[model samples]
Target: MTMDGGRALVLGGGGVAGIAWEAGLVAGLAGRGVDLAAADVFVGTSAGSVVGAFLAHGGDLEQAIEIMSARPDGDPAARPPKPDMDLVMTAFALMYDTTLEPREARARIGRMARETPTDGRGAALEEIGRRLPSPKWPDRHLLVTGVDADDGSFVVWDRDGDASLEAAVRASCSVPCVFPTVEIGGRHYMDGGVHSMTNADLVEGASTVVVLEPLAHFTPRDRLERELKTLGDARTVVVGPDQAAIDAFGVDVLSMRLWGPGFRAGLAQAPAVAAQVQEVWAGA
Candidate 1:
């Protein structure tokens, strides 16, 4: 791939495992003198948004790797208390009362919802956000993607936008039912992966783009293919885990077992493509 000038880096949504993979790939590229964080623009979806936020605000690869690989679930102090099942059941019962006044039911349900504790997702995102940029920290051209739940429209958050970097990243990382939907400007939003896995399409005007895709290696999707095709039409290179890496880390997104393999795979894969990446960057 040959480029004219500007470079964009796109990070796709995987999960916990995806995070490890992306971290590895970025670090690997950096080792080979291809610093993805130095790109003119950055586009992140789900897990990508987590890593992207860090890189966008002058964070380093080692920091990203350390934070992303940490086992947050294992720490009791870090984990949020579980929701009261009794309160959840009461809310469910309230839903079945056909004759109950709408106002009363709504009030009751809202109260129960308030009483119910968050499952630590908010806290986790907060902790991760702490390591990344705050609102408009450096004015980088960072774009975070999310999907509006109300109408299924794709959302992109830029640094100059009103939404804080944390809010946008939270919205972008919020998986449908697993994590709470984030509300920004009165609209509910969820994971950007619902619309595009890596969001390579966002790199439209960049002369060259590098896509770090964690899911496309095993879980193929037509949407992803179309996005890649669009990037290919311009000048783009896609990197994903090879078969050995896949074998080392299974397809379980939530499993922490893949972190090491993913990281190593990234380092290993970088050398092979370093020259090609340089050529693409140089438009040789």
Candidate 2:
């Protein structure tokens, strides 16, 4: 498959695992001399924004891989305290009513959120933003995902708004209990994954959709393969984690499980994804 062509890259948001796999996939394509910037369209959700935004800024594949694989999670002592069941339950309660349990949850989490250092997502976006001509993509070259705080609706940010690089990434990666919602202008925003997962039709005019999923490679996931078949008129490619890498990181919660697992396994998963993409681009 030709790496450089009229191709549309679809990025999924699965936290660090997604970032790691997609970063490696980009590196693999670059290793074969592909210019990611030349690709016609790019779409990213949640953590996928980390890499997609980087490309929109004219950075190379290695740059994306480095940023995604970087150990930005930091030392445990220096980072924010882990969220407990109380924090999660409180956040859930607050999602519905802001004046009751939700308000209490917000108050509790707000203090912790302010205290805990950023989850490294802001730093990654800022690094790429430095290379960008502007925060908004000149056109729709880089489309990021976000959810409306008021109605819980899905919104795709095409690097068009006045939101800063860090702000956009934070909105996309704002996992409920893990990272607190960010305020942009005056609106409260959280992670986009809540609404955009497997919703590829959200992107219009995509000639082909390339989904990079970082999860178990089992029959249950095969459903995703079938679901994508009808996503759009565009050709579709679904790449799952190498079956061997499933248990590598172990099933766990949001923090280390998201970012840490892919640091090593992602490097290995990249080449395999490279091979899979050959068919994806064969008709691109």
Candidate 3:
């Protein structure tokens, strides 16, 4: 499907620290005089959706950084549970075990996805979503992605859809096992990152697409490559965490301790990609 407008901005999911990184990227881009909020369409999955919402509504960049950068344990408004260490370890084990058949591995992952209690990290997201513009800016189009927990189907919530923006973003950011699956309009929804961390393909007809991905290294290569291939002639620019940035942010997506480093990493990485982004946008 094609985006209504010629340009699209895509955001990829990353956990707590990821928010900081993306915000930093936003700030860095702003400093470079690159304003991404002008994009015609926005596609966001998981943590990406949170930032996308802010951009869609014209929220303050520094304010978003401050809010997302808060340590969950220390934030009075948040009651996030500690990282589910067992789930993390088990997930890694399942991913590395080549002995299991694809079907069996999928089954195990499905089970693991639902077994953990909702750790309450989502409360902040819900709060943020609620505080965003209710009707949203009419000129902008937003697409928030999520996955249906029961049927394992991919879901895309558009700004014009019946679902409230809050519900859509909440479901999109609901990382399986870390946050509870959201039930909206009879469907149980969870993180769309399970399917594609950056659903860039959704805006197939756009003339240009800018993808800001925090977990680019971890995303399946085939999936991202295929999505880019599907974009056909659209000019696509991607900026993601390099090795140094990834090291600074830490690989633990659920951790909240390294937001400062994550933000700094994004700031450091921005200049290298700024020219590419400027060229694409100018050409678009």
The prediction achieving the highest lDDT against the true structure is 3
Which runs in model 3 stand beyond 4 Å of their true positions?
A: 70-79, 86-111, 119-139
Candidate achieving higher TM-score, 1 or 2: 1
- In order of appearance, the predictions have TM-scores of 0.76, 0.70, 0.86
Give the candidate number with the greatest TM-score.
3
Writing each residue's lDDT as its tens digit, candidate 2 over 1-284 gives 12233566767776656666666666666676544445576667776777677666665545544543454557342234555556555544443453655335444444444454455434433443343335555454676777655445566665566776667777777766566667777876666655544445554455656776554342245435554555556677776667555665454324444444564566566666666666666566
Residue-wise C-alpha lDDT for candidate 3, range 1-284, written one tens digit per residue: 67644888898889766676887787788789787888888888988887788888787766656655564666633546665777755753553457976345534554566676665666655655665545453346888998777756678988667777788888888776677778789877877776677888999989988998898787556768889998888988988887888888665766656557777878777787788888887678
Ranking by TM-score: 3, 1, 2
Candidate models: Cα lDDT each = 0.69, 0.57, 0.75
- Between prediction 1 and prediction 2, the one with superior lDDT is 1
**Candidate 1 segments whose C-alpha is farther than 4 A from its true place:** 1-5, 68-118, 133-137, 229-233, 256-261
Reference-based TM-score, model 2: 0.70
